[model samples]
Target chain A: MPSISLTLNGRSVSGEVETKTLLVDYIRENQKLTGTHVGCDTSQCGSCVVHVDGKSVKSCTMLAVQVDGSEVTTIEGLATGEELHPMQEAFRQNHGLQCGFCTPGMVMSAVDLVAGNPDISETEIREGLEGNICRCTGYHNIVKSVQAGAKAMGG
Target chain B: MQNFDYHKPNSVDEAVANMQASDDGKFLAGGMTMLPTMKQGLAAPEDLIDLHGIDGIAGVAEGADAIEIGAMTSHSVVASSALIQSDLPALAALAESIGDRQVRARGTLGGSISNNDPAADYPAALVALGATVKTNTREIPAEDFFVEMFETALAEDEIVTSVSFPLVEKAAYAKFPNPASRYAMVGVFVAKNADGVRVAVTGAGPSVFRASAMESALDGDFSSSALDGVAVSADDLNSDIHASPEYRAHLVGVMAKRAVDACG
Candidate 1:
């Protein structure tokens, strides 16, 4: 086992993991942060999305050792106390999800989308979120939520 | 993915040493393709040599008439790079259109070209733009770098350092992306310069290839309509569930036209 330390959410934590252990597994199993869901074993789905070094990445596609000293922010870190992030609030207000299995990844990905650009169009949002797949809601509400969230983020 | 020892080498020499030491060592850049392939049990290397730790392997250097991009540079970086967007907008657009936002954030230019997937987008751009593939040992022209499906001219122990793309007067890339995977069903990259016109077709064949007919036609008339009479035969093209070789050959003509029209 190799010991690795990284900044998770806003704090620093360290753990031991095998060479092949994925970052999502390390986050969920060792660190007990289960909000980051793994919907697809393949890299096509965005269910395992997370922010590494302040940029969105598929957590399942990255190994724990690959991001040893980097900063990783999971869906669990999106809130301050009880208040939801603007993007999360927008998702809730716009009904961006149905069963909510894909919401965490969707919201995390949306937050990055909004943060990366000040002005985003509906088409860009659709193209931007292509990595994230939601079986339900048809993405109409998700697109609406992203537009509203971008506004909420002061984009 | 099976258990594999990992080494983060600080230099290209160290990485090569690590590669030579292992039974079957893989140089890992972004892990966008390699990780999933491993998880699916398609490949199982005994060792993984992570190259991200190495410095000087992840930046862009601009010359008078060319841009040298390090292998570790990610697609997102290349897509949004001021140098690339300004100097090579076609390359930037191609990078921007790869996979998706998340995949772009992690996928590297070197990995994409090295893997040489049949439907991948970079090979077409590199081949059409007449780029140079610089490895640890020697520099290879983009045309010779890609050998066959999921294979390149790179040796097992060699590592790609950077690729130098000579600036062109005009170039553009257009693709008919698969609705599901976004990998190109038929992608075309067209470039024109003082020398002549070069057209590379990807996703329509076993590997990226030059459309000599289209290039000659465009060399004569520098217009999309110039390619009206030229046609690519479906005979040697790839046929899969997503698209037939006939359709892919048709797309080759259509995408080449769009690419030529978009060229500046």
Candidate 2:
């Protein structure tokens, strides 16, 4: 077993895991952070998206041991107790989710996107969100949510 | 997934030494391709030696006569690099169009070349630019490195350290991507080297191959019309869900023409 330690959702967590244990599994099982969804076992669907050391990564595509000493922020970490993060609030206000399976990853990816690029347009939003897929809502609300979130974030 | 002992070496020497320590160990660069394959139970290795923590393996070096990029440099790094953009804009474009932004950030040059996926873009650019792939043990010319699909001439335990591409007069890469997967259906990279014109095609065959007919035609006359009568035999081409061998052959000509135009 490989002993891995890292900051998850602003808290430091360490555990011994199998060499092939995925970051998603560690987050869901060990850390008990089930907010991060795993839609496709393959990396095609970005439902397992999370920020690794401030960059968006598909958690399903990475091993838990690979993130040792790195910072990981998931959707559950985005909110402050009961108050939602600005992006989450914007998504709620804009009705950005449908079935909500992809909402956690979508919101996490969107927050990173908006933070990196503030004055992003709709086309840029679409391209940035290409890695993230939303089956419901036709992506209209999601795009609007990102735009609104960017505005809320002064982006 | 097979059980494997994982080692993240902090230095290049450690990585190379670890690789040489065992024959069952595989050097894991960016796991963009390897991890997925492992999850699908396609590959079952006893050990995985990660190369990410090795310093200096993820940078772009602008040399006097050529640009040397470290093996672990990601596609996003290459695509956004001002040096790559100015030196070879088409390479940047091709890099940007690979997989998507997520895969671009994770996939590395070394991983792509090591995997030698027939549809990968880096091999086409490497071959067309007459690049040299430098490993820990030796340097192999791009033309000789790629042998077949998912295969390379690299010996066991040989780790690619860097790739150096000569500054060309002009170079361009054009690819027809599968909409769903974003892997190239047919990718053509054309470059005007000091010697003459070089054309390399990927995604259409079992390995990246030079388009001799197109190269010969363009050497005489560098024009899209020069490729009109030239035909690539479909015998060795790849037929996948996205494109038939014949369609890929057609895309080879079209993308080659587009690359030539872009290079001009």
Candidate 3:
């Protein structure tokens, strides 16, 4: 087991993990932050997305030790004590989710997308969310939520 | 995934030494493909040498006549680089079109080309641009780098350092991506330089290949119309559930034309 330390959410955290322990598994199991879902276990689904050093990455694809000394942000870190992140609020207002299984990853990925390009167009939004699959909504309201979320984030 | 001993080497030499010491060691780059392959039980190595700790292998530099991109440079970084966009917009566009947002954020040029996935987009760009792939040991021309599907000219311990792409008069890449996985069903990259015109096709065959017929036509006249009667043989093309060999053959011509039009 490798002893690794990283800034998870906002605070510094350290743990011993197996070499094959995925970042998502470490976060969900060791840290007990179950907000991040593992919808596909594979990298195709965006359900396991998290910010590693401010860049959105598929957590399921990265080893836990690989994130040592880096800052990691998950869906749980987005909200500030009851005040939902603007993207979360937008998802709520626009009904961006249905089953809610994919919301966390969707929101995290969307925040990074909007942060990268504040003035993202609809086509760009659709293309940016290519990694996220939503079988329920057909992405109609999800696109709407991201558009609204971008505006709320001062885009 | 099988449990393995992990080693983080701070230098390319150290990484190579660690790999040599292990019974079955694999160098881990971004791990976008390596990790997934491990999870699927396709590969099982006794030791994993992580190269992320190695510095000076993950940036981009502009040379006098060509642009040198470090092996660890992520697709997102390449796609968003202002220098690359200004000088080699075709490569930037090609980088942007790979996989998706998250995959692009983590996938690296070295890993993609090293794996040499037959359907990968980078091989087409490398072959068409006549880029030079630099390893820790030596430099290899792109034409000789990719040998076949899931194979490259890399030695077990050789690490790709950087790739140098010469600035061209014009270049563009067009791909018909598989809707489910976004892997190129048929991708074409065309480049015109002082040397001449080069056309490379991927996702349509066992390996990325040069389209000499289309290259000669475009060498005479660099235009989409020049590919009117040019055709790629379907004899060696890949046929899967996603696309037929004949369909992929047709797409090679169509995508090559699109790439030429995009260059203009």
Docking class of 3: high
For model 1, the superposed segments whose C-alpha errors exceed 4 Å read none
Query: If ranked by DockQ, best first, what sequence of candidates would result?
Result: 1, 3, 2
lDDT of 1 at B258: 99
Per-candidate RMSD vs. true structure?
0.9, 1.7, 0.8
Distance (Å) between predicted and true CA of B73, model 3? Answer: 0.3
What are the models' TM-scores? Answer: 0.99, 0.95, 0.99
The Cα error of candidate 3 at residue B200, in Å, is 0.5
Candidates sorted by TM-score, best first:
3, 1, 2
User: Residue A3 of candidate 1: its Cα lDDT?
Assistant: 81
Clash-forming residue pairs, model 1:
none
After superposition, the stretches of candidate 3 with alpha carbons farther than 4 Å from their true spots are none
Give the per-residue Cα lDDT of candidate 3 at B6. Answer: 95
User: Superposing every Cα of model 2 onto the true structure, what RMSD results?
Assistant: 1.7
Q: Model 2 in CAPRI terms: which quality?
A: medium
TM-score of 2: 0.95
Q: What is the lDDT of residue A131 in candidate 2?
A: 89
